[model samples]
Target: TVQALLRESDNYIPQVEKIKYEVGNGTFVDDGGIYIRWINDIVRYGMYASKTFQRRDILGVYSGLVTRQLTDLEYAWEFNYLVDVKDEEDKKIRVCIDAKHMGNYMRFANHRDTNQNGDQLYVVYNDLWHVLYIAQAEIKLHEQIFVNYGQGYWENKKKYDF
Candidate 1:
């Protein structure tokens, strides 16, 4: 459904073309191992923003946590490091979007983790700006992690009613 909406959007062509060019030039990976490709393209083309950070690095951190590859000691160490590195003053990051103007179709959900913790996430159909912004912000925790891969985050075994 999201793919279909994207295909229907006039802006989708240029965005996809830019992604193809980037992948072809080796500036971006084409293997589809990470959803960051789609996110980055959204930010770069859809939002008209410059590349502010490396998506791959951020994803590596998420992979470590999600896969339980980080040992207790490692996790503690990283947690401390992150706390120390976090902004001490005015630690808010703001994202402003005119949804109506953008003409974006977005969806949200909630579900439960394997451990039964509640998580909430969102999705956008054809709106690269919203999709990528949410993804990047979630990856950095500048905003909450609202999406997991292509699926919505789960909370309490029940998906959020959109």
Candidate 2:
């Protein structure tokens, strides 16, 4: 199956960005890093890119525990995605990925209002179970990456404690 594996890895690239963090009142003196911080329970997470990314560049991929879905309802997890997979019996099964236990650097990125600039990245290949965070704009050095959580997510959720 070497050929098959190589075919899949070809679909992805060497991850271009690294996920980093800072603490309260700490000066962001470090160079070539991305940072995430929490203030009074509000996530002020930001990504400081060490390299620039062109539009449509794959930022990162989301991978985690895949389990059977309990209908179309969103699964309870900080970062996750839903997709369908075929069972051994050739039947379709809706799956909910619990990314809380496993994910890449993009998991640390913040969520922005869709109308703002959340579209910077998006989830792709839902059915294939490989969710990618693609850059929607020309990202410059020292910029943060954000993705739209969508109205469906906002309508039923409170993102943080303010």
Candidate 3:
């Protein structure tokens, strides 16, 4: 009975192959054509592509639970996950995708100066902005996926003088 239950759960698992043609969330995909790998002593883990991706291919959505801005300085680096968006009144405000505890594979993407992929923030009908990572160039298999976390991210960490 336990094995049968597990087999049924597989049906709900996200798969990249079943993704829609549009550039939205990738079937809530995780562990698709990507994997988490050890980097080095400095950079702990990084996400790498397991298959070649053409330019502008939708990788997956940076899916997470949305919440208001977090002011905890201890976890300031997580601020990179926060996105600025306009509210219903058209006033700009910061919204955070609290992905630390719950999120898809996109959270493992590291920062790169010349990243092969870039993220596009899209606002759905719910007015929540979702971060969508797309291939900036033709990326071969095994290449690391990186996105520019923006200048503000580094500026917040004065020690990261780059």
Candidate 4:
């Protein structure tokens, strides 16, 4: 039902300011800039904080192509980047953002079975849905940004041997 898929409108442009980070010793020292690093051979890549971030700090936006379709190629691995979200309406509709091809560094954030350091918030602006990351705990420098991707995602991963 590609016809049912809605295209995002560019008419509503939000005036977002760029976040600045203080560099010290070749790394971000303040405001907690984030970066992607190699976690391990199994986990592959993961996101890390450059500085300390207190609980409830706004980390960043989880930007990507909003879609609902899961193609065969995506099912093999890109499926891991698919995140479910709710629309802004009286009756919410479940949708997902495919971050495989198009997304910011937030896509590198890894999943944690326990002790999640970050949480996702579905915020609505001008009827458009956006995923914002909030620090659930005190995230220190060089710490992994762990998010609970939920049980549903794990179950799907197991089915595909991902």
Candidate 5:
């Protein structure tokens, strides 16, 4: 069905007509070698040349991702941790992160720890999602935390003396 439609469309016009138009307009040569002369003209001069000009907004909206705003601290924490999950290729999973969404996750008790005078603390939890296993773990910010995923220790916090 699609093949038939494509054949009938202007883009898939008969080869004979296409060749004639090309030849007559000097788009094609007959020196034992066919050279496209009107290629630039065809691309530059046209009312219905591209689909983008016809449906730019629809294309933009379709390409955009739908996101929900977060209003709770707990939800924010979960969202933050989940957002850290990245592909092995280091690509971000979320298409976009809004301020509200970030704020929700910022409410985590350990999101950014500070002292009485707002001095940054030495202890911090940096959780990351493993792409292959889809598991989350917390690693100490300034310390090395060994994770034993095979042993089912996802969030086991052990101090590394070394």
Candidate 6:
């Protein structure tokens, strides 16, 4: 049975916990809920759902400890993973996540429909001072999650074929 989450209005804020740990080579949130695999040669790391989540649900929170605060956006995109958000000092910041060696389940989310999964995951820089991943649509069990890859990723891509 589904449990109803009550809120005063659509803007109701829920308490979200931050869990930071290794994703691929370990378990997190649940007992190893997410896994990485591929049938053959693929684009790269793929994050699959081990559990189902309702639409507008809080899927996961990006709680990686290691972050980079770049003075400019030019060198920030050089890293493989990154998110632009406001830090504790109330300043615009870009978080460069090095998921190649260390990361969590949230890193598996694709950008610019790179995984051909559309936009299943959404990046929300919450007012509670954290970046959380919300479900863009109803996420079924065992399905792959995706987030809107920033504009820079779509500049060269032709059409929304992916």
The most accurate candidate by lDDT is 4
Across 15-69, the per-residue lDDT of candidate 1 in tens digits comes to 4456547857889653322221133322221111122223312221111122212
Worst 10 residues of 6 by lDDT: 1-10
RMSD of each: 18.7, 9.4, 11.8, 9.6, 27.2, 8.3
Model number with the top TM-score: 4
TM-score of each: 0.23, 0.55, 0.64, 0.65, 0.13, 0.53
lDDT of 5 by residue, 3-34 (tens): 45333332322333444478679886432211
lDDT of 5 at 47: 12
lDDT of each: 0.27, 0.49, 0.60, 0.62, 0.24, 0.50
Worst 10 residues of 5 by lDDT: 55-64
lDDT, candidate 3, residue 120? Answer: 40
Q: Can you rank all candidates by TM-score, best first?
A: 4, 3, 2, 6, 1, 5
Candidate 5, pairs of clashing residues: 76-104, 76-105
Position 25, candidate 2: lDDT:
45
Which TM-score value belongs to model 6?
Answer: 0.53
lDDT of 4: 0.62
* Location of the lowest summed lDDT over 10 successive residues in candidate 1: 74-83
Provide the lowest-lDDT 10-residue window in model 3. Answer: 73-82
lDDT of 6 by residue, 1-162 (tens): 001212211232433322433444454436554566562344455667777777666666554444664343321232223334666897875556344444466766665544333342223224323445676667777887777657785566544333
- Name every residue pair that clashes in candidate 1: 110-160, 111-154, 111-155, 112-154, 112-155, 112-157, 118-155, 119-154, 119-155, 121-146
The parts of candidate 3 lying over 4 Å away from their true place are 1-31, 71-93, 123-126, 158-162
Clashes of each: 10, 0, 0, 0, 2, 1
The parts of candidate 1 lying over 4 Å away from their true place are 1-8, 29-141, 148-162
Question: How displaced is residue 30 in candidate 6, in Å?
Answer: 1.8
